[model samples]
Target: MQSTATSIKAYLEEIPEERKIAFTKLRETILENIPKGFVEQMSYGMIGYVVPHSIYPDGYHCEPKLPLPFMGIASQKNFIALYHMGIYANPELLNWFVTEYPKHSTQKLDMGKSCIRFKKMNQIPFELIAALVQKMSVQEWIICYESAFKK
Candidate 1:
């Protein structure tokens, strides 16, 4: 479910108390591991990491006023969702994740293109997710994003 929260603080306050711990931890992980030039805010009703307009002047294609989305964390009806634009846009990145995920996590990987679903906090592969987030800088991600459209 997309939250109606206007800010990250509001978003957290809206999440169920029990889910807060896991979500907060994931948020911290993303912040600690996210590449330079990314900003965190409430976007798409989740905690979003984005390439700011200063970094990517055109902003997001779908919504030019907004920053280019890189990753997001959302609380859904049944699970927490992690969205990775890099993984969805780059086959090599996706393949790397699919292969490396098992090495770090014995839990089943539940994903759909860019979205990883976790029914429980323990199911999340924190280190693997961190590596994935750290893999691309904003400039590299922009190139990848544009290249995908050219294909």
Candidate 2:
């Protein structure tokens, strides 16, 4: 669900108590492993990791005033979601994550394009997410995003 909270801290406080721990850990995992040059902020009503305008001043094509969004994490109505633009743009990365998912969690991969939904919070695979987060650097993401989405 989209949140009205303007900051990550406020967003965290708004989510259900049952999700606070896992969601916090998930956010921490991303913060600790996400490559440098990415900035954290509230984006599209979620906690987003983005390539700032200082680096890519063109901003997102869909929303030129905002930063280039690379990834986001949110506590949805029924699931927690991780949205990674790199995997959606790169077929190889998507294949790699799909293949490695079974090794990390027993739950069937519940995914849609870029959004990986974790219905069973206990089964969230932080390690695999860490590895995935590191797979794409800021420059690489810019290139990939331009090649695939920017006209």
Model 1's TM-score against the true structure: 0.95
Per-candidate alpha-carbon RMSD to the true structure: 1.3, 0.5
lDDT of 2 at 16: 93
Predicted candidate 1 versus true structure: per-residue lDDT over 1-151, tens digit per residue = 7899999988888887768888888888999999899999999989999999988888888888999998999988888899999999999999999999889887888999999998887768888878888999999999998888533
Runs in model 1 deviating more than 4 A are none
Deviation from native of the Cα of residue 119 in model 1, angstroms: 0.5
Q: Please, what is the whole-model Cα lDDT of each candidate in the order they appear?
A: 0.89, 0.96
Provide the lowest-lDDT 10-residue window in model 1: 142-151
Q: Which stretches of candidate 2 lie over 4 Å from their true place?
A: none
**Whole-model lDDT, candidate 2?**
0.96
- Model 2: which residue pairs collide? none
lDDT value for candidate 1? 0.89
